[model samples]
Target chain A: MKISLFATCLSDAFFPRVSEAMARLLARYGIRLTFPEGQTCCGQPAFNSGYWVEAKEAARRLIDAFRDSDYVIAPSGSCISMIHHHYPALFRDDPAELRMARELAEKSYEFSQFLVGVLGVSDVGARFPHRVTYHPSCHGSRLLGVKDEPLTLLSHVRDLDFVPLPFAEDCCGFGGTFAVKMADISAAMVTEKADHVRETEAEVLVGLDMGCLMNIGGRMRHRGQAVRVMHLAELLYEGVRMADERA
Target chain B: MSGHNPTSTLAERVRIALNNDFLRNAVRFTTERLRTNKQAAAEQIGNWEEWRERGRQIRLHTIAHLDYYLAQFAENLRRAGGYVHFASTAEEAVAITLQIMAAKQAKSVVKSKSMVSEEVHINQALEEQGIETVETDLGEYIIQLAGETPSHIIIPAIHKNKAQVAELFSEVAGEPLPADTAVLAAFARSKLRGKFLEADIGMTGCNFAIAESGSIVLFSNEGNARMVSTVPRTQITMMGMERILPSWEDLEVMATLLPRSATGQKLTVYMSAINGPRRTADGDGPDELHVIIIDNGRSRQLGDPEFQEVLNCIRCGACLNACPVYRHIGGHAYGWVYSGPIGAVLTPVLNEEKEKWAEVANASTLCGACYEACPVKIPLHDMLVYIRRRNVEEGRTKRTERLGMKTYKVAVSSHRFYQLALKLGRIGQKPLVRDGQIPTRLGPLKGWNNVRTAPALAERSFRESWQALERELQQEMAEMSPQVKARLEELAGKRGDRHEQ
Candidate 1:
């Protein structure tokens, strides 16, 4: 399977390791990966900040970048959701572009959804021994209905102890530009989320999207906590390496 | 406290709410309890989505043909010997209310928790005219005694704790009252009972007006609304024009959604449906009934596609309970009669002063939880976004934020610009980076870094390292086991064939 990676701008700029892990994990599964160099941002920050014209420009660029890919997958649920749910609405005024956007939306999938739903694979031959908890991103769980896919995949990992996150459905307050714009409210929310994470006493916090992890992890770091944050792809890749070494 | 002062910005009000630890805990506890009960009630009813859809359809059909339904309601009301008056503005509604009060020589009025009265400032208007007005609902009575506006819609005094309620009630009781719930409620019930008997006129907000029968429905737990509608000789009901439902059958859906969403009850303790005033043979009901249908900016949304659904709201407060921002800041931060997610949209749309009310729209995370929690399925999150976009198009946004968004747009549209900007950011962030996190509160990072540290930019971006990684991957894939490679190729070929079919 040829999968075009939509490494979100955040992953590309701040967390390149996430994209690397995604590539390694997919390659281990015998899926060839391609990167469309023309991709940049998903235009969520602009669109969510009420800059429709600017968001449209970014959307058009992304639409053009992955026009030919048979399958487009992204490690970030938020960016993938921006394409799968919001892109068609953005291009409603242009008929040809709207049709293309709709088609692209049908083929685009978040990382776990692509792995679990499209590939029909749950156990990716990975192993992990530490306790872990998953934070379901708002877009992933609510918008894209990617509920249980990440959990299903995680539950299959050998020796992985999964604890449920309390109040897991609540947003982490990393609402694109909302974090900076409404910093006070965002801080209060992330503080509550961090508290929940601490209650679970999970050594590592895993999430499908990097934006939420970055926000929660950054807060956890500032509070001088030792809990580590890892993307699901990175965790899965690490598990695969562990399994491979044990073999 | 009586109404939104409009003197402070939404940010300033939010800061005040944030600083109040007691208010935060009170709001959080009450909202959490309400949210849990609502979830259980929804589950108990089974097929909640179907009920929600039916409620949405009923509201859409009524609001779309509001003219016909409202006319039918007025005709039926008049046939029942009730007077229906149309008020186009707040002042007009107040004037109509005062006229009815004067004709009946009403000196004292008892109100039963009407948001429309708050919207029109009827109590203030009446008080200024030397008429005594009292709030009958326990929560409203507490806030009224404290001279504060309602913070939450369903629970008017949601920001007040038991201790605060005791203090407020003590002032009214002319004695120190204990903070016990039973003591406070008893004090209020007894005090309001006296006012209900002495008041010459009763005023209540219409929850849902049944168009076919011309009956006005009021949903309350305390039965004070029933008292207000029955004890006075003359009655006045203030209704937003969009509150009409076509028939009692439609009321079934609203009845299912409203109470469950508001208080999580199977039904409000008292669901009173009164048609006009008391007939000649009736006992313990109002002698004269007057219904005032107030437009008050609601007509502006009649044909508006973006905000017309906002009227479908049943004032359930489910959105408020579900909103994280509201849980933190409480209802006072919204600085209006309506608060929470609904207030974020309704305040701006219902008020003609968009320049000021538009600030309310900025007080949301656009998390869409409110949309998920809505009983009528009003797309409140989408409406909030539209409100923000309208504000920006109207040039109401801050210049700094506007310029920042523009720069972001230009940088994010091109990979070259985006990578260069990231590279620049990496260099610029060096002085601020400590332990792989930016901890300095400076410039744009001040607000963010104040509460949470930011991750430092990667030492090498993905794009810069991609070519080398690609070469390494090519070498690794070339040495892969033939069996695995053949199996993957065959699977890809099968997927391609399936796609072609």
Candidate 2:
């Protein structure tokens, strides 16, 4: 019943409301939550940029910080994927650290995966009236196999109309540092993604990962569109707040 | 329009590709068609994953014992009255090709679609020697007239639209031709048929070389490969050393995967397997056949752990169709004979010039679509990471980016430093923040803000709000009914048990 939050660095600094929403939603489900202050970035930027040694430094720090938690969950799919899939590979040379990394990976879960898979709660008795579309982040949908969990949960939300995003599985081009390193290609990909979002004609775009939302939402803002972007956690929390007010 | 000049920086070539709306539309249309076909074909072939795994295993086994299989292939080929020549480098391959051409007194040579010939610059080399070399494949012939290398592997003239093709073919025909597919095809067929009949040597690239039978296989939709291998009195097949299959049974797996992945066909129009030169009783076959096995830079990857699996590639170009970057920039921006995700990894690795081709590697988003699309399951995305790592280690990365990454590494490893940096960033963006986004192209945001705005930093860090949220959560949990709490706890316990198991 106890969960430790792994608020990714992006969420921690730029999208704090996502973590706040996650906390509120988990509490409504009668779950106990703790924040591990020592938690930092998941080393994805370094790891993805081919800086293995630097990534290992951050990985070891994360592993040590969450070494005692029974369940460590992150709001971001990409960071969780880095821990669950990449950590063991990072520590392959050292058996002790490798074992610890594997153990940590086993216990870590992406936020939506934790909600639908672990908690077995699809509808939290909440209502959302706006038309919404979902963008499945590449790491979450493909890498972590968190494909249907988010969609299934959204489908169960009371009064929420879910429109399927066209080319939903394609990446939003927030490839960590790739957004800057190959900005031109990244812009093109995000442009196409924004076009897809417009085609859906959804009022709000929801995704589990903040990195993707930031890129897509930023593009939407740049084009001066009125489409609102919300993290899945924020939407779920909004539902909980609405239900609580009615009660 | 020979392929984009290799000397131009990738950025320059990308600029060119971006500006050419026609090229972008052509590449996108062709790749989208190919991708849709491949998806449909994959669905038609049930248990696609199993088929892919089988293909990967076959390629892996062959590449693992490449030496033994290649030797067996050479022996079997020689036994079939074929001459085998080994070329360790591109220059050596060109030299061997020219030597055979001279020995046969070959004046006009016809070539089927061959990437290796492109790699070796064989057309230029042969033309330099006053030998007429005609590309027989329709796409190749179009690009050949354009004086450009292939942009896509399967569709070599992928960047050319029907109008462009008509223009290219018209120039070769000495008359204006309509922008009709049928007209272009007819023109190419008539012109190539003459060249195929008059040419003394026919040069083709091997798709898969059956080791046991010592037969080289060619898969083509246009049937040009058959002509290149049959009509000419002398035949030459250029093969990468890694293109080996242990037996015909293994070829079945490749046969299933290659066509489906390349163009989503159940089979290429022609899948020709030639054992050797024409036997005395054989009809409509070359009198003399020569097989050239070129290592070039492939041998450098034989024992390499990170890259050995790259040799397993079937060159299906599924990765190209699946890549977003390639879809935008086309193949020319790769600034090499090969382009797309495979080209991003292969161009640097094959050339062994990591520094020169580092920009090509950087061009990718590392999205792993290429890995997903690969029939042989080559970890091209991972190899790209390794390539980027090599670039960084070799100091091929930009100095500013290197310093930035170093600073990022330092800042992100600790929560305290990460928090401090965010606080600073929030304050530093006061002048830049407009309507909740940073829209100015300044400093590090120049490239990004040019096309898209970046989100302004949050006023409050999550860490600052967690304490209050945790307090509220504790109160809410305490107020929950006992029965509801027990049920949730029990459900959580069961889920945990299942996960542990």
Candidate 3:
């Protein structure tokens, strides 16, 4: 499968290794990944911040960039959800843009969703033995409906202890630009999430989206906690070796 | 009627609320508890999404044909020995309510948790007419005593902790009382029981009005709605015109969705369906029942494609729980009787005051959690965006903010402009940069940077880095595995076939 990887701007800049892991994992699944250079942001940051015109322009760039790709995959569920779900609505007035946007929306998938739903694989045979809890990103859970795929893959990891976090569905408060704009409220909300993570008795917290993980990780570091955070792709990639060795 | 306090804006009120530590803590605790309870109940229900869609369909159908259903409901209500009045404005609503008060020669009135009454400021109007009105809901009673408006829709005095409630209750009791829940509730129960029985008129909000049966349904855990409906000799119900459904089958969907969405309950302790005034054979219910259906600015939203769906809100605080903004600031920060996502949309649209409400829309993160949490699927985030867009279109935005957005639009629309802007930004931000961070204490950035320092632009842009990666990707795609490629082709074929169908 030829897949265009929209390694969301955030991951590309701050967490480049996540993209590296994503590329390797897709390759293992026999999916050839293409990085469409013309892609910028998913226009979510500006769009969410109420800069609709700017967001639309950015969306235009993105739509044109990967308009002909067989499949567009992103490691971040939130960003993938943005393109698949939000782009069509963002370009509702323009018929031409709307058509392309809808096509892109249909073709785009979150990494785990692509793996489990499209690839039809329950176990990518990833193994990470750390006790970890997952924070399902709000957009991915509710918008994208990537509910149990991440967790299902996580649960399959051999010898890994998966602890359930309390209020697992509650938002982690990293609402794109909302964190910078409403820091006080964001801090309070993330504090509650951090508290819940502390109570889960898990050594690490793993999430599908890097944005949420980064937000939670930053707070964890700020509070001087040693709990590690990693993306689901990285964990699944780790398990592939185990499955191969066992075979 | 109480005049608008020219001293403060909604933003100013929210500012005061944000500063009030006790109010914040109390509101947070109560909402969190209610949210938790709601979650547990939804889990217990088993097929929550199916139930949610059922509720959404009913609300959508009813609201789309609001005039037809409301007219049918009013006609049936009148036939059932009830008086129906239509109020086009809040003043009209108050006028009709006050006319009922005068006709009854009522000196005192008691109310349950009707948001319409608060919206109309009926209590202040009645008080101005030298008629005493009391709030019977315990939470509302406390806030009423405190001389304040309700901060939350469901839990009216959510901003007041038990200590604050005890203080307010003690003043009403003419004796000091403990902050214990049981003790406080007992005192309120006894105190309000007197008002319930003695008041000449009772008023309440309609949760949903059944069009087929001419009945009004209310859900309440505390039984105050029931008390307000049954106790007074004369009862008045204020309903939003859009609060109608086709039949009892739809009511079942509402019954399942409302309480569960609002407070995470399988059902409230009491769910009452009042058809009309008490019949000659009945032992209870009011002798004279009057329902004042208020449009107040809702009619303006009738044909509004971008906003009409907002009318489908069940006033379930699930949106509030799921709203990141509401969870932090609490309800009072909304600065109206209604708070949370619904409040942000409703306040401006209801009042037709875009200038004041434009700020309320800004309070949202537009995360769409409210839409997810909505049992009726109101699409509140989309509505919030629409409100902001309307605000901008109306030129209600501040000059600086408008100019900034215009500049942003220009720069982003053109590649040359965008690259130049980023370069200029990196250079322009040098003075503000202290330790590679833009610490601006001026402009709108002040509101943000006042709390947390902004991160400086990275050394290399992601757009720049993707070019090399793109070259590497083309080479890899050339050597793709045929097995996966075949699978992709099959899936594409299926999708194409489905589209053709």
Candidate 4:
């Protein structure tokens, strides 16, 4: 079965390290994850903003790019959510594309889901020593039902102090264009979320989705916080590196 | 902005709500408590998903055969000696209500908390005809005293504090009242009790109307819904046409989900299931009953696949309490009878003023909190997107957003333009990046940068480095265990079977 990496636009453009960490970490299991460069985005920005035609334009490319891949892995659950939930609806008028979209949706998995769920590798034989709190991205947990996979992965990290972030289930107000359109309300929400993050007092703040991490981490930066904001993949990869050095 | 002047733009409405510290704190504190309690309650209920699914199935089944059920309901209600009036619009509903009041010679009307009544502007119509109408539900009473609409579906006065309630009560009492909860409750209880005893007619909103028994169910913590349906000589119920359950068994499922989702109660303090007006053998029931089944744009959703499930909402306010946006801005920012996520979707669609109410749909982060919290799982996040799609399709979206989306289409239509855009973004942000962050509050970044810094684009896009990364990983490839391989194939096989179904 061909497995392709769907490095979401955010993961692709701004946080390539997350994709690198994800690829590097998965390789420990001998799984060769392929990258289909023809993929640009899952079209969530336009889709959520109400431009279905534009969203469909982007979706069509994605459908074409990964047509032959047996399984698809995306770092961001929000993009995976779009592929699983909206792609079929977006391409309902075209039978061939719709069938492909359905198959793609069935096979696509968020990174942690691909790890803990598919591979059944929670520990990944990694160790990290730091105070870490997780902000479960809203789309990842709520929309995609990716509740336990991340937690299951986190529980296996050696010496990883997992303090829960307060109101961690709450959105970071980064609804793609929502941050731009409803600025003040989004600001207030992110401020509250940042305050909760500060309350955790953890050395590292980790999450699953880059879009949300950007929103919350951006607020932390705006507040002059030095708390490290890393994706779970990066943290796991670093932990594996630490484990290797200690060994 | 549930009560804000309709002319105010969503930004202006959001500005007002955000700026008011008192309103913000009150809304946030109350919703936090309600949300926490609801979480605990859902956990205690064990098998919350099963209950949610049951409620969803009941509603879906009823709505699918709504025409049959509605006709059966009218016939059953008529057989029970209850007068059923069908009103296709708000105006017609209001006219029917006025006609009932006129026929009964109703000089005064006492009402329980009724969202449908608020939707129809019932008090205004009654007051214009020189009929005295008083709200008996504590929250509704406070809102009535202030001459404002309810900001919340469950907690109508969620935005008000004790001091505000005391101040509102002080004017009614003709004396200064202390800002104490018990004292205010005593004042309202005494004041509303008199109205209930003296009023000629009682008005209520139906929570669920049972078709088989020809009964209307009322769920209330305040016990005022009981009084409104009882004490008065005449009773008038304003039922949203969509509020119907096929039987008492379905009601049992609804009863399980509504209160737990609303306020964390297993059951409301008073769960009154009234089967028509009264029998001669009944001692303290209304002499006459008028059930006004108001369509008022509800039937518009009946045939619509996108919006039909919105009718499945049990008016529990779970979405309001769970919504991060509603928690910050309060209900008035929505500027409608309904507020929060439900308000965001319905205010535009129900009003059929998609162009006018377009911005209401923009207020959410599409987080799916509302859907997760909904008793029947309405998929409000998806609906919000659909509402936005409708707006965009009708050209109701902003010019800038339209242009931005158009540009996005061109950018992501293929990888070449996408690569160039990434390169341009990196180059463009070089001047803006301070310590690897764009802290500038200028141009399009103004809204975002006002509260958060922005990130500089990666030096190398993922695709740019994909070839090298693939080459690097090839050598390090470990042998996969056959068991792991089999498990993955089995999972994939199961997924394939699901798609065929």
Top lDDT prediction, candidate number: 4
- Please tell me the interface RMSD, in Å, for model 2: 2.6
Supply candidate 4's per-residue lDDT for B420: 92
Q: Model 1, clash count? A: 1
Q: Write the per-residue lDDT of candidate 4 for residues A140-191, one digit (tens) a residue.
A: 8987899999888889999999999988888889899999989999999999
| lDDT tens digits by residue: candidate 1, B36-81 | 9999999999999999999999999999999999999999999999
Candidate 3, residue B501: Cα displacement in angstroms equals: 5.1
By TM-score: ranked, best first: 4, 2, 1, 3
Best by TM-score: 4
Chain A only TM-scores, each candidate in turn: 0.98, 0.98, 0.96, 0.98
Task: Give the per-residue lDDT of model 4 (tens digit) for B211-302.
Answer: 98888899998899999999998999999988999999999999889999999988889999888888989978898888999988899998
lDDT (10s digit) by residue, model 3, range B336-375? 6678889888877887666766677777766677887788
Query: Could you list the iRMS of every candidate?
Result: 2.9, 2.6, 3.7, 1.0
The true-versus-predicted C-alpha distance at residue B442 of model 1, in Å, is 0.8
lDDT tens readout by residue for model 3, A1-247: 3568887767755566677677777776667677766666688876765667767877887788787787888888888877877787788888988878887888888988888888777776666678898898888888889998987788778888999988787788778766765566666678788889999878889898887887787677556677988888877776676666777
Query: For candidate 1, lDDT tens digit of each residue in A1-247?
Result: 4568888889998899999988877776656678888888888888777778888888887888888786888998888888877787678789998977876786788999888876677998899999999999988887788898899999999999899999888888888778887888889899999999999999999999999999999899888878989999999999989999999
Q: Between prediction 1 and prediction 4, which has the larger lDDT?
A: 4
* Complex DockQ per candidate: 0.54, 0.58, 0.31, 0.87
TM-scores vs. true structure, each candidate: 0.96, 0.96, 0.90, 0.97
Which pairs clash in model 3? A125-A239, A126-A239, A127-A239, B38-B264
lDDT of 4 at B493: 83
Please give the range of 10 consecutive residues that has the lowest summed lDDT in model 2 chain A.
Answer: A24-33
